[model samples]
Target: MFEVEVKYRVPNHDAIRDRLKALNAKFLEHTEETDIYLNSPLRDFAKTDEALRVRVYGDGTVVLTYKGPRIGNVGKTREELSVTANDLDSLLEILRRLDFREVAKVVKRRDIYNYENFTIYLDTVEDLGSFVEVETMVNDKELINRATDEVLQFGDKLGLKREWIEKRTYLELVLERGNERR
Candidate 1:
């Protein structure tokens, strides 16, 4: 499951949401993902300078991802892990008790999934203004290239990143932009 993706700066969420609705897409609940980066002594974790995070995506969509996992290292993989959600309260209650380690910033991101096999996420960081992400999984180089092209086409359609093909994870860009905003 190689993940090929791109992102752009969105003018506004409402504008994008309208387009998504026109495409028969729905806005999923906003997910507050919390990442806890750690220090490792060996293996890939030690060689790189990134953070380890335990992400909680709305309700019970819990996952543990590196704050800065090497770019493209886990790109082509079914790398996401989400938890079962009966209701959001139980999950929120659990999070309230745990003392989560803080990082440089906390990001509030809205997830919009296209029934057409793509997911668009709108992120609003503590400092960063606004950004959007389009992610799709592909296998083989040709398909990956095609997917990249497709994403680029949509980006153009949306008037985003028309020339800049960005592949950084949402976290990295948001963090950098957020830091700059301050």
Candidate 2:
């Protein structure tokens, strides 16, 4: 499915949470997530703008996700394929044997909300601070444009300013920040 999403850097997460409640958004789940992003030895994911990661959530659920390059100029719209994994260790081992190296790990506390067609994430990311992501899944490629527009509009309804929108993933942002400190 296509994951049409938009993220924003916000100063106060509590304010946004209140706004979501005001809009009648449903509280989903609060989870601590650690995402381990891997780099394929054959292709440079950094140059290609693709991602493969294993996310382990607080409730002990594990998910493996592959994210394709971003599409369009407006938001972080992309093709995302994900599945639940029964064994995180085995999956990591398989990736390692396949020459995929661990690139970065992002730790975050996420509060999820459901509002209409969107799954909203209020994330407190370690080293990067607070942000919100609104996303929806689309089955058809033709629906990406309309879905992107709708997601951005929903973000605006949550009081997210256009200028505050961030297109870079947390992994990219963290890697860039690390390089800058060198």
Candidate 2 Cα errors over 4 Å, as ranges: none
On residues 7-64, what C-alpha lDDT tens digit does candidate 1 reach at each position? 6666566776667777777666666664433334333343554555555565556555
List ranges where model 1 is wrong by over 4 Å.
43-51, 66-105, 163-182
State residue 11's C-alpha deviation in candidate 1, in Å.
2.9
Instruction: Score residue 74 of candidate 2 by CA lDDT.
Output: 78
TM-scores, one per candidate: 0.64, 0.96
Task: Give the total clashing residue pairs for model 1.
Answer: 10
- Strongest candidate by lDDT: 2
- Leading candidate by TM-score: 2
Model 2 deviation from the true structure expressed as Cα RMSD, one decimal place: 1.0
Predicted candidate 2 versus true structure: per-residue lDDT over 36-147, tens digit per residue: 9999898999899899989999988999999999988877888888999989899999999999999999999999999999999999999999999999989888998999
Which whole-number lDDT from 0 to 100 does residue 52 have in model 1?
A: 50
